[model samples]
Every structure is written in structure tokens, then in C-alpha cells.
Target: MYELKTKENDRSVVEFIENVESPTKREDAYKLLDIFTETTGYQAKMWGPSIIGFGSYHYKYPTGHEGDAPLVGFSPRKAKISLYFATGDTKREELLENFGKHTTGKACVYINKLADVDVAVLKRLIEQSVRFLQDTYPNNNTN
Candidate 1:
């Protein structure tokens, strides 16, 4: 069985933000905390050691691999803030087209700062990701 490293934990979200090496990143983390909280209507929880996550859902693949993951989350990393979102949603790509300056990986969106992105679009992305996951894995949520 494969283990997921980024499981949710009882660590302090505030303490994690406070320890961010860059003051600017720390401030942005707080701002992101507020935005994500208000948008998701869920209190932030620490995922692993770094990610500030909101809601969670359990997923099982066709191969029988399964795990729980946050609906949406972000980490104020050394180089850029990584935003987590659902991977297979076409709407996610459409929204990212107007999401201001950001880079996307398989499931992570990277941005230099909050100013570089539209907060409204960010909220939509959060909502869409949560909705998609909840629909995909109905009744399996830890929200």
C-alpha cells in the first residue's frame, strides 16, 4: 500500500505562517488565510508541515489506491505560493485563463504574490475545486 505524505494534522496554521522566512510571504499567507476561509467557509487546517488546507475528501483510484486530500489549499513556499486545486476539471483551465499571472502544474498553481492574481478568480477556483471533488467523491468528505 502506498502512503500519502500530505495528510492533515493538528499543527497550528498560525504558527506555520508566522515562521515563514519572508515577511512579505508571511503577510500574504495571512491574507490568503482570510480569503480561503471566507470563500470556503471552513477553518484552515495544516496539511503535512506546510500546506494550509480547508475542506477534505477521500478518493480511491481504479487501481485501489486511496487517500484523503484537501479540497483546496496553499503553501507559502520559498520561491512561490503553491495553490492546490482539482486536476481533471476543464473549468479549472478556463478560469486560469483569466486568473492573472500564475503558473500551473498538474494540481498546483504557482503565484509570486496575491497581488499578481485576481482575488475573485481565486475564490472561484477554490469553489470549483471543492465542488468538483465533493461531487466526484460524494459522502466521502471530511468537511
Candidate 2:
């Protein structure tokens, strides 16, 4: 069986944010916290050591691998802030087209700062991710 490293934990979200080394990144973390919370209507939780996550869902792969993951989350990393969103959603790419300056990987979008991107588009991405995961894993309780 494979283990997921990014499981949710009881760590304090505020404490994690406060410990962020960069003052700018720390400020951005708080801003993102507010955005994800208001948009998803779910309280933030600490995922792993670094990520601030909102709602969650359980997923099982065809290979019988399964795990719980956050519907949306972000980490203020050393280089850039990584935004976790749903993969395989065509609308995600469509929204990214108008999402201001950002880069995308298989599962995350990277931005230098919140000021570099449109907050409205970020909210849409968060909402779409939550909706996609909810629809894909309907039985998984969120929040």
C-alpha cells in the first residue's frame, strides 16, 4: 500500500503562518487564508507541514490506492506560492487563461504573489476545484 505524505493534521494554522520566514510571504499567506475560506465556505486546516487547506475529499485510484486530499489549498513556498486545484478539469485551464501572471504544473498553479494575479480569478479557481472534487467524489464528506 502506498502512503500519502500530505495528510491533514492538528497543527495550528495561525502558528504555521506566523512561522513563515518571509514577512511578505507571511502576509500573503494570511490573505490567501481569507480568500480560500470565504470562497469555499470552509475553515482552513493545516495539511502536512506547510499547506493551508480548506475542505477535503477522499479519492481512490483504479489501482486501489486511496487517500484524502484537500479540495483547495496553498503554500507560501520559497520561490512562489503554490495553489492546489483540481486536475483534469478543462475549465481550470480556461480560467487560467485570464488568471493574470501565473504558472501551472500538473496539480498546482504558481504565482509570485497575490498582487500578481487577479483575486477574482483565484476565487473562481478555488470554487471550481471544490465543485469538481465534490462531483467526482460525491460520497466524501467535505469540511
Highest lDDT model number: 1
* TM-score for candidate 2: 0.97
Residue 60, candidate 2: Cα error in Å is 0.7
Clashes of each: 0, 0
For model 2, residues 13-102, the per-residue Cα lDDT tens digits are 999999988999999999999999999999999999988899899998898889999999999998999999999799999999999999
lDDT of 1 by residue, 2-110 (tens): 7799999999999999999999999999999999999999989999999999999999999999989899999999999999999889999999999999998877999
Compared to the true structure, candidate 1 yields what TM-score?
A: 0.98
TM-score per prediction, in order, is 0.98, 0.97
Which stretches of candidate 2 lie above 4 Å from their native place?
none
Q: Which lDDT values do the candidates have, in the order given?
A: 0.94, 0.92
